[model samples]
Target: MPYVNIKITNENVTNEQKKALIKGTTQLLVDVLDKNPATTFVVIDEVNTDNWGIGYQTVTEIRQDQ
Candidate 1:
């Protein structure tokens, strides 16, 4: 079994976008690794900009500073 996890900030990505990411990545893993699509799993997490960090600052802070 192969596990894949991806994280992205909550922005323009919609619910459908998240579903597509999971489906596409799973298909790729199945085709290239010869694994069952059912056995592959993907997790998408939507985080607030204030909760996510970059360097020593939160994403919200960085965006404001820029």
Candidate 2:
């Protein structure tokens, strides 16, 4: 079984978009690694912008600056 974890900022991601992400990730693994979709696992984590940081600043701060 192959396990994949994906993390993204907690923005207003719709359910349809999340479903597409999960399906696409699984398909990629299937195509590249010959992994079975039935056995592949994909988990999406939505972190608060304040909790997700980059370059010594949180995503919230980065977006604010933008």
Candidate 3:
């Protein structure tokens, strides 16, 4: 079994985008590593900006600066 873990900030990602990510990831694994898609697992973890940091600032703060 192949397991893939993806982490992204909770920035209002759409359901269709998430689905596309899963499909693309699986396809990449199949094409590159010859992994079995049926047994492949893709897990996406959406993390809160407050919980994610960039250097000394939180992602929330970073975005506010931008």
Candidate 4:
């Protein structure tokens, strides 16, 4: 019963990539912590750049600067 929460900015991540992320994360837990894949839970949360902030600036603003 391992629950993992992953947060990423909504920057056009493809479904294939997201699937890989989930699979890899689950495998990591299985390898490191010996967690059961069937009982492992992974949640991917996509937040809009405007809603994700870093160092007093939104991800959108930071990307704009970059």
Cα lDDT tens digits, model 2, 5-50, are 9999889999999999999999999999999999999999999999
Which residue runs does candidate 2 get wrong by more than 4 Å? none
Q: Candidate 3, which segments miss by more than 4 Å at Cα?
A: none
What is candidate 1's lDDT per residue for 1-66, written digit by digit as tens? 889888899888988899899999999998898989878889888889999988899999988888
What lDDT score is found at residue 47 in candidate 3? 100
lDDT of 4 at 30: 98
Tell me the deviation in Å of residue 60 in model 1: 0.5
Q: Residue 32 of model 4: what lDDT?
A: 100
Clashes of 4: 0
Candidates arranged by lDDT, highest first: 3, 4, 2, 1
- Candidate 4 lDDT over residue span 1-66, tens digit each: 999999999999999989999999999999999999999999999999999999999999999999
Per-candidate TM-scores read 0.82, 0.93, 0.96, 0.93
Alpha carbon lDDT at 28, candidate 3? 98
Off by over 4 Å in 1: none
Worst 10 residues of 3 by lDDT: 1-10
Q: Highest lDDT: give the candidate number.
A: 3
Q: Measured by TM-score, how close is model 2 to the native structure? A: 0.93
Model 4 scores a TM of 0.93
Candidate 3 structure quality by residue, lDDT tens digits, 7-51: 999999999999999999999999999999999999999999999
The deviation in Å at residue 46 for candidate 4 is 0.1
